[model samples]
Target: MLLVMTGIAAFPWPAATAQQKGGFRKLAPGVLTVIPPDKSSADELLHGDLLEVTEGLSGPPENLAWEPQRSPANTTLVERARNRSFARDIWCLEFAFKPPRMIEVDVPAADLKMQRKRVWYLVYRVKNTGGRRTVVDKDDPTKFKTETFETPVRFIPHFVLESLEPLSDAEELAKYRAYLDRVVPTAMEAIQRREDPRQRFYNSAEMVAKEIAFGEERWGVAVWTDVDPRIDFFSIYASGLTNSIRWRKRQGAVINPNDIPGSDMEVAMESLRLDFWLPAAGGNAAEQEMSVGYRGMFERMTLGSRVLEATGWPKTTKSNPAAALERMGLKWGDLLEPVGGGGPSMQPLEKVLTTIAGLKDPAIRTALVREMFGDVGEAALESLAAAAAGPVDTEQDKRRRAALQTMGLTPEQVAKDPYKSLARIVGAMDSQPGYAQRQAMAFKCFGPAGRRLEWLSKGAKAARALAAMESIAIDPNSVATGNAQTAFEAVRPSISALADEAERRKVLQGVFGPRGPDLFAAAVAVHEGIDHDWVFRYESDGPGL
Candidate 1:
């Protein structure tokens, strides 16, 4: 069903008298596409009206004496054939997206009954912005001009979901699952109800390959089913939204006509790549916030999550390891269960503290602390890294230092020569990243028998337990507010009390900042462009599970 009511607009056709922001636009001179009928010609593909080819360009000039690789045997079909009167077509659509969301909707089944399914969907809006581009002028065919014109643009949307989780190079190479967009007939209506009932939304297929004229905007939703809820990180490659492309011609004595555009010929489609991170994915997880990121940012996040998970840091910190990472603005998560258990046991805080206090030797205490905090050993080893910084000039030193600062080097591998090593310089940090969070948390000591200790106490649970019992909640305003009943109470009332509302929160927070549901409502708001959702799930990271 074409839910979009294609109506005749007020703005005149392509080239109107005046151009308004959200109105119909006019086509400039030479606005027509020049993609010829025959695409089999490699020459045509390589150099269109835009006969642009980059070879040994870009990058800053460097002082070096090295032999450039020359494949003298390699030759091109048309060695010295050239044509001018060209221009590059780089038309773009204004694209913006909301974070991916899941909607439980009913779908038509084989037996004709409606089967409810969980569909993961992304919502985005695209508008033809009447962009400027260099084109061969119609008036003078030899000359070129940059004009802003809104031409008819047909959107043939192609969306592919790519997992960005890094395991090992080999495992990661084959570890990902690329999910293609699906046409879920049943999902459209359900998504609309969940999103905006007033607006019309189209799926990848339903979006007619018809020209979306200038001044018009379209909303689309690409959906997928059977997406791994266990997916920690991924990127959505949205293609066909724009008709822009870039290519690197195979440089040689001759352009081989038989050459497949794989290694040598680089044809890069201009697509919108959107990265997202689902911090928590499994059934045991909570509020799986789908965070938006640039390309590869999610990989760092997953690495943090996985590393902490492997170390069982959440258990040590007595807080949700995932939540800890988010609170500290660290892109991270801890989420995997590799079968079969028995590992070295972590000593409880009380036991560790007792043993530490009893140890007389300073060296042994230091070693034990190092054992408890592996970053200490890491810090020690990192102290000696400068010794390897042999003979190097200022440029090399600056380059190497920048590479060293990468947290797994997003794009930081310096090359003095043909140093073929994509390998990163992995070292240890002197201190863990999230160690110094000065933010105050609502804390309460629930007496001696161990408080889960809820907070990261570093063996201070014994003291917290003592404090919980000795502490009493009192309000002098009970008499003034006519709630004198609190004074008459024997134990001064439980944590939830007469003055609870005034103070405003948990017995912990009520005594401290008066403060602050859920995943679904937040997900809905995210679609509407209000991206806000962060919650500390546990009432109290207190005593028991």
Candidate 2:
């Protein structure tokens, strides 16, 4: 990552009689020596043998003995040649710098002392040193080689300038600003025109060392002229005056590993802050940087049709809610029948008889049916009597006849007033193996508008019973908003009486779990009605609450 240019000891100027012959010589492992082809090429030479070094070191040998040549123009000429011929190993050229001279460098007062009159030019070189060929057989303009087995190389430049003085007058400051504006655009143009694929997206970042002045820090302005526009990069102003540079060095990039996907947004915003805002603030502003990171992520997730397919969710359609419900295998009556009984309902009353009847778990079914259906309902009573009177010997048929007998309901009575006879069937649900089934059935009959609130008020003690009542009130298809509000009012007192947090949570779950949107609003209202702090605390607990 270093570039070095040094003056070498003068060597004897060769005569015309000397023969010219030069080629590469391996001086050491990975080191090579380059000899000038003729004595004329060697005359007043700053470098006699070119030495190849590795990356990471800073400069070349200090004093190799050679005959001294005596001429000023010759000295200048030799210096330029040394600068050109003193190339480092191409692989190691991550950074390059122009050697420091005794010239003056403008910088800010804070950075004035630290600024050095040295400028460095560097290009990040990615070299293909492997013997294998690439999978894609195409020429890469950014690269030096494109053929299979050819060594590919691309360069990204870096320029470093040290020790600058601040501008002394307004005119100088304006000139410096204008200069920067011109240089940045020019550098971006060069990057855009680069044909190398590897260099096409390369970005440039400038570091103005501590010694540079805000007004006079023009030491490294031209370096900004050669950067690629497409590459996203930023510059850091290292102010030496107030120890800002020290702080930056200590902080480095404040990355938190725990932040994960979201933190990358923070990093990008930080870069943007340094590039656009730091200069105006003199490097000490404390405002938090704003970013589009999460917003952008959300946009990508929701806006595009492709993301929906990727996540296994169906694309949203403009069809109305009724159409969507039908697609889900639901119908209007299925949601509304528990409140009224004026007409013949759907034939699958067994399925709609109660939530308990639909349950696969016999134990839970027994618990639910027993608590909710205390006796056979008119619907169930009719179904049972019809099955019992029919000539049937199947185990299911026997079970039905035994259920009617246990409930003290004869086949004739069951048929005469099946709905009225529901009381006895519900009572049988509370006995032995049917309790769970009764509870489940109660859940099923709790739909909105189909059943009367007066009937529900009778069994509002059990959490599941209260839940069914509320379910009927909040059914989306029902005109039971008044009933739902009344139910909420009725249940709140019972829920408040619960002594244990766990029991209260269970009641709340039943209320809110089945009718989420309605209950959410009710809960929020209750929380606010008592204390504003409660509302804040509940929301702050996040979705986990």
TM-score of each: 0.41, 0.18
Model 1, C-alpha of 128: deviation from truth (Å): 1.0
Q: Residue 111 error for model 1, in Å?
A: 6.8
Model 2 lDDT-worst window of ten = 240-249
Q: Per-residue lDDT of 4-84 in model 1, one digit per residue for the tens?
A: 101212223444223224422333453211121111212112232111221211112321213346733223212212332
Maximum-lDDT candidate: 1
The models' CA-based lDDT, in order, is 0.41, 0.27
Instruction: Indicate the residue-level lDDT of 345 in model 2.
Output: 18
Q: What lDDT is reached at residue 406 by model 1?
A: 44
